[model samples]
Target: MDSLEQLNQRLREGVRCDGDYPPVPGEGNPNSPVVLIGHSPSGTDAQTGRPYSGPAGELLDELLAEAGVKREELYITNLVKCWTWREENGLRVNRTPSAKEIKEWVPAWLKPELELIRPKAIVCMGGPTAQHFLGKDFKITLQGGQWLELPEDSPYLKLTGHRLDPKPFVMGVVQPNYLTHLQEHAPETYPAARANLVADLLKIKRVLEGKLPKPKAPKQEELDIPF
Candidate 1:
């Protein structure tokens, strides 16, 4: 098996999809017990050549600090390695990746990286990422922060074509970028979103440290309440 470094190098030199920016590799310790997955890189990330290093990145750092987790202690990556974009008024505007683009990249890039890192817990930030791993019908508004176990025959595992020695615990959280926008434009929703992000990260920390209890399904009432 190629090492994580080797696989990352391969990805760096790989071809980018049409209308996509170059791939941005995950950062932080490969041996970290937790992994954070986001939807994709933004224009800032594409320019910085780093995942989560823009305004959204700042929000993430703040949330992680509030949760008592360090940015350097968790492996951070995106669902899609490349930046999906469109030219808008002579400037490249970041756009959400299509399902086809996501499907193509996972097996080719993200899956291999996961196989090598083998994190104990995974926090999927944003709807697309959560849906990608959890299933097509996943609703982050209802399910954020709820712990879930990957089934033995999960489609995600099948898609990866890699067997994880110990299946990682998974949870969903709101995207930092969305939260930032909320903070600026929808002040009323910002506090709740920020609280939810911090709480979710704390849960991930507990899971990684083996302090969290066994997983259970969220109640209907719990699902009804937005996080």
Candidate 2:
């Protein structure tokens, strides 16, 4: 089977949830620079078999648009291919999948999805997806907003960072959900997070276009929002 077909088969068998993956792998622009990774399919997303639905997705789409990356120009996926939820007092509440679960499912399908897309950079949306895509050692507080090498033995089952003709760099960022939270609860941190995200996207763009100068990460002050 071709890579996409193989990826779907793994998703069906590996992820222990009812959510369906996108009917087919999204046809991202071959020129896309970043792969946006999330943790799992939300309830609506699972039923629809699409990544990012409802308000969260709309916010993410807006963020991407602000960064000059169109939806069609980027690839998106989740650490777990299906939605994992539990019934709580008659309501289904989402829970973060366990580390063991992420380890089990991501390698089988998500990694293959990355291999097929072969994006220039991987932008993990939150700590969980970041950790899943990079390795157990991945840390958001320590490593967020910087480019780093994907660890050896990553679940990118068929995708090997060591084997890349030109290795792709991985980046971590605050998830849109957290961004929304910060906007509501701790407005102080919102500007910085948003700035960091845009800066990272610009850096990714420059690197992909061959204009970047050996990855000189900008300092926090340099990322100050232009007003």
TM-score of each: 0.88, 0.75
Model 2 error, position 73 (Å): 0.7
Error of 1 at 129 (Å): 0.6
RMSD of each: 2.9, 5.6
Q: For candidate 1, lDDT tens digit of each residue in 1-227?
A: 88888887888787664565677888888998788988788878887878988888998898899998889988999878888888999998878888788778888888888988888888888767776676655567667778777655555766776677667877878777777677778999888777877888888677557674366553332232211
Candidate 1: stretches off by over 4 Å: 17-20, 152-155, 218-227
| Model 1 global lDDT (CA atoms, 0 to 1) | 0.77
Candidate lDDT values, in order: 0.77, 0.64
Clashing pairs in 2: none
Output the worst ten-in-a-row residue range by lDDT, candidate 2. 218-227
lDDT per residue, candidate 2, 1-227, as tens digits? 34665666655555445433342233355456667777776777766667787567787777777777677767777777667778999988667777776767665566566666666677787777666656656566666778877556655533433364346777777777777788898999999887777766665556556652343232222222111
Candidate with best lDDT: 1
